[model samples]
Every structure is written in structure tokens, then in C-alpha cells.
Target: MVTIHELFQNDGQKSRIGTTYNKILYVPESVLQTIREYLDAQSESEYQGEDNTIIYTAKFPDGREMDIKCCGCQEESSWTEAVLFDEKGYQLTYTDVGEKFEGLWELEYDGIHYCVDVKPERNNSKMED
Candidate 1:
């Protein structure tokens, strides 16, 4: 099992998909509190949360950069994540899909509240009902 510690590692490793979650889930309570505190400190940071979806620039201590875009946040149901890019925003996609899109993505899934300034898993983008 992938622990919260593993999911939120800040060491610049790209996260891998271990399983598909059936429903929306929050980061473990212990981790949630930590994330909340971290996010609170970055309150001045700006992102797309106001308009439902999220589009923000993320920088890591390891000198990596990427723009994250999360969709379907304003709706009560249905969340769609996008394929994103590295460095400055551009375009990318899973070669298997052949559905090319601009941008590199992050996260085990879409829209995890309190992950405002925290970098998400650089792999595993998806849309779940």
C-alpha cells in the first residue's frame, strides 16, 4: 500500500498509480492536518480554486517546475484531470491514448483539497465519477 508519506514526498520523485480508488477520499487525517498547516502558510499563493478548476504553477526544491490543471472542481460530481507539461506550460499525453493535450499533470487523482502549494503525484491523471 502507498502510505501518505509516500504520496506526498517532496524529494522530486514522480508518483506512480498503485490502484484506482472507487470514491473520493481524503488524505489520512494525520497527513491532512499537516497539509492544512502547510497550505495555510501559503495562503498568499494563487491558483484556480476560485473558479472550480485549478491551474497553478508548482516549483520543487529539487529545481523542477510544472503547471498543474485540475478540472470539474466546481461541480458536485464528475472530476476530470488533464495531461500537462514540464518546465513552462506546453503539451503532452499518454502515447497509448493518442489524445494529445497541452500540459503535464500531477496527482493520484484530481482535486485534493489542501494540496494548494504541495506538489502532487506527477503521474496518474484521471477523471472519476
Candidate 2:
């Protein structure tokens, strides 16, 4: 499992926070690979060479999964975890990814942005909060 967090420097104070994956964000396999490479390269450039900065995890199509490590981009607040839903199929989520948001949405990672269209699950529960 990959664990992703966002680190921010606000008013000279360092803060690290978790990202919320409440929407459907999908990208091509190549794009995802590029992201991993970029992070790996950065890690190699660091002076200390400490490899405990960020973590990465993969999500399966099935619903059985657990939280995992994440990358620095996700840890640095550049990217947030999101679920992917098939417009005409079904919605699968794990502990790492957030809720499912359908329709059109945009995502920007490391100065790159992607547009996706998702079909969210239908809500028919009788209880409301």
C-alpha cells in the first residue's frame, strides 16, 4: 500500500496533511508511469538521498484493498487521491481512493492537467444525513 500526504509550508511553519479523494480522476497508464518516474528522478537528485519521503500504491478494479504508500507529488499537495468510475460500468473503490464523482472533471498534476468523464453510482438509500 502507498501512503500519500501533502506537505505545505505556511507562514514559515511546516505542515503535512492527508489528501482527500472525493472525486473520480482517471489517467492513461502512460501518464501514471510518467508521474512515478518524475518522482523517482527527484528522489535521486536530493542531497541526503533519504528514500523515506513519499510512498506509492496501486488500486485494483475489485473492491478489496487497503491503504498504501504514496508519492511526493501527492505528499506535496500537487496531487490528491481520487477514484475512477466507469460511466457505463460499475464503481470500485479502495481505502486509498476517495468517493466516486461522476461526469466531467479536470485534474492537474505536476503542472500537467487531465480531463476525465465518469459515471458515478446511483444513490438510492432511504437514509439521509
The local distance difference test score of model 1 is 0.31
TM-score of 2: 0.20
| Residue-wise C-alpha lDDT for candidate 2, range 24-76, written one tens digit per residue | 33334454454455444434343222334332222323322212223343223
Number of backbone collisions per candidate, in order? Answer: 6, 16
For candidate 1, give the lDDT of residue 8: 45
Model 1 stretches with alpha carbons more than 4 Å out:
1-51, 60-64, 73-82, 94-129
Residues 63-95 of candidate 1: C-alpha lDDT, one tens digit per residue? 233333433222222123334343444443312
The true-versus-predicted C-alpha distance at residue 77 of model 2, in Å, is 15
Q: Relative to the true structure, how large is the alpha-carbon lDDT of every model?
A: 0.31, 0.34
Q: What is the lDDT of residue 76 in candidate 1?
A: 29
TM-score of each: 0.24, 0.20
